[model samples]
Target: MTLKEIVDKLGATVGLGADKLDREEEYCFASDLMSDVLTLKDTPVLVTGLCNVQTIRTCDMANLEVVIFVRGKRPTEDMVELADENDMILICTPYSMFKTCGILYGAGMKPLY
Candidate 1:
């Protein structure tokens, strides 16, 4: 699904880079640890509870097109700026990590590897 679709389906808020919402997402990964995310061989739509500038940096290294912050964790001002600079789409969801991943997976979003 596209980032726009994920946001619409999940009732998520576009925290930043709404223009990039059209980017397509093939998979979703839910994790709080950057280290675990880094280990993923395939790039996926990252769903995380951690909200910080580091998330943007990790997205950069991972080449992640979309990031969904679950449980309503808002990104910082710096994080928004970093996401813009990195050309990443940021989203905020009210759902917890488990529910968010489950919903996406149930909707046929598989992990890329």
Candidate 2:
């Protein structure tokens, strides 16, 4: 689903990249470790409990287009600025990681194979 659609369905609030909210994301990966995400090849939406600037750097290195911070953790100002610099869409959801992943997966989003 498109980022905009996901936001609408989950009632998530956009933290960054508001203008690019309509961008389509075909896949998702849930993790807090940047190293693991760096190994991924397919472009996907990232779901993490992490809310730091390093997450933005990892997203840049991994070529991810979107990040949804689960459990309502707010991204720091530095992270938001870095995400804006990297052109990544950042969002926050009230759902826990497991529930959020399930919801997205049920909605047809998958991890990169």
**Tens digit per residue, CA lDDT, model 2, 24-112:** 77888899988888988787888999888888898898788699999999998888888888888889999899988888989999777
- Candidate maximizing lDDT: 2
Error of 2 at 8 (Å): 1.7
Candidate 1 structure quality by residue, lDDT tens digits, 8-70: 878899988888777777778888999988888777889999998888898899887689999
* Model 1 spans > 4 angstroms off: none
Give the alpha-carbon lDDT of every model: 0.86, 0.86
Q: Which 10 consecutive positions of candidate 1 have the poorest summed lDDT? A: 19-28
Query: How does candidate 1 score on lDDT?
Result: 0.86
Q: So what's the TM-score on candidate 1? A: 0.92
Local lDDT at 73 for model 1: 91
Alpha carbon deviation, residue 1, candidate 1 (Å): 1.1
Highest TM-score: give the candidate number.
Answer: 2
